[model samples]
Target: MAEQKNRFPLKRREFVKIAVSFLPAAFLLPATARAMALVRSPVRVNRLRPPGAVPEEIFAGKCIRCGRCVEVCPYRSIELLDIRAGVFAGTPIIRAEEIPCYLCMKCTQVCPTGTLQKISQEKTRMGLAVVNRHLCYTWQSMTICRTCFDVCPFKEKAITLDQLRPVIMEEYCVGCGICSHACPVTAADGMKAVTIEPIYSWE
Candidate 1:
């Protein structure tokens, strides 16, 4: 037993040196937390808040995470953010590519916290749809595809045709994402020719 103990020398000293090396990191933890709290996550394409949602700056604080909006969605469009979303965890989000908001306006009525304010279907502005001309078949003159314009809820008001190619009108667009979901031309990255971008709904 005594001989076995001698196999390791200066074990306590080595541990102490390693412990001191991590001290600086420990002190930085508080500052890192503060910085993270101050910085809001950047708005991602295709991921959007439900219609009538307040601005991003105050959304996290105002939301109560009741899951009411998710329960009332007829199309199962709204989903709560998971813990990985940091401070915004449990807030409602719509992944437009997977299931576009049908604009039934049911979610806005069920939000007890006013996180999603009650609004008419025509007034909903989730995000703006931007078209990637490079990936569009109609734009490239490869084919005459009218899938986006046909699928749009607002029809000619939101999306019009110029020489058989789709043109997105920004002012009349409510960003329901139906056009993005129905787009047939998909790139290697899984992005459709049209995709929704954050347009600050309150604006």
Candidate 2:
């Protein structure tokens, strides 16, 4: 009984030593985390919406971020905006380089709210595909690549080749983003030669 009692005080002293060892780490943990967070870069999002999505002002107000649009996307093209997006946080965005919307029309059908109205392919009007002639292989006559024309859902009306130069018919193009995704050249800025621009933009 006396030996056991002697051991108890020794164990208590060991526990106090271990606890003291952690004191410095505990004090530094918060400061280390804050420093790491400060060094981290912010996420950049496309200020654009999916097909059949409402206007930018209305979209910011209506989208509930239920992730239904993200879930139903067949091409896995949809992504939820980060908290860094400010007023547009949790909204659906599509980065064409990652995976562009193929216009299957499934996301619109699954939206519980009318934020994304179920519209037919012909009426999607998500955004227009703009080709940077300087970056296009066909425009430079470097290669006979008809990637954009072959992939367009509305090739006859929205896109046509004149001497192998693909032209985007703005009025007919629904801005589905398939052309941009199919483009071969990815610029240094991480953008494709052909890109989908919001239907309404500063340009």
Candidate 2: TM-score?
A: 0.73
Per-candidate TM-scores read 0.80, 0.73
Best by TM-score: 1
* Per-residue lDDT of model 1, residues 1-203, tens digit only: 66766986657789899899889889889878766854555347888999998888788889999999999998998898877677788889998888999998998888888878988887778899999999999999899999999999988889999988899999878888888999988899999999999776435
User: Where is model 1 more than 4 Å wrong at Cα?
Assistant: 1-39
Per-candidate local distance difference test = 0.86, 0.78
Query: Per model, how many backbone clashes are there?
Result: 0, 0
Compose the digit string of candidate 2's lDDT tens values, residues 99-145: 77788888889888888888898987777778899999899999989
Q: Give lDDT: candidate 2, residue 127.
A: 75
lDDT for 111 in candidate 2 is: 85
- Once model 2 is optimally superposed onto the true structure by TM-score, how far is the C-alpha of residue 171 displaced, in angstroms? 1.6
Give the candidate number with the greatest lDDT. Answer: 1
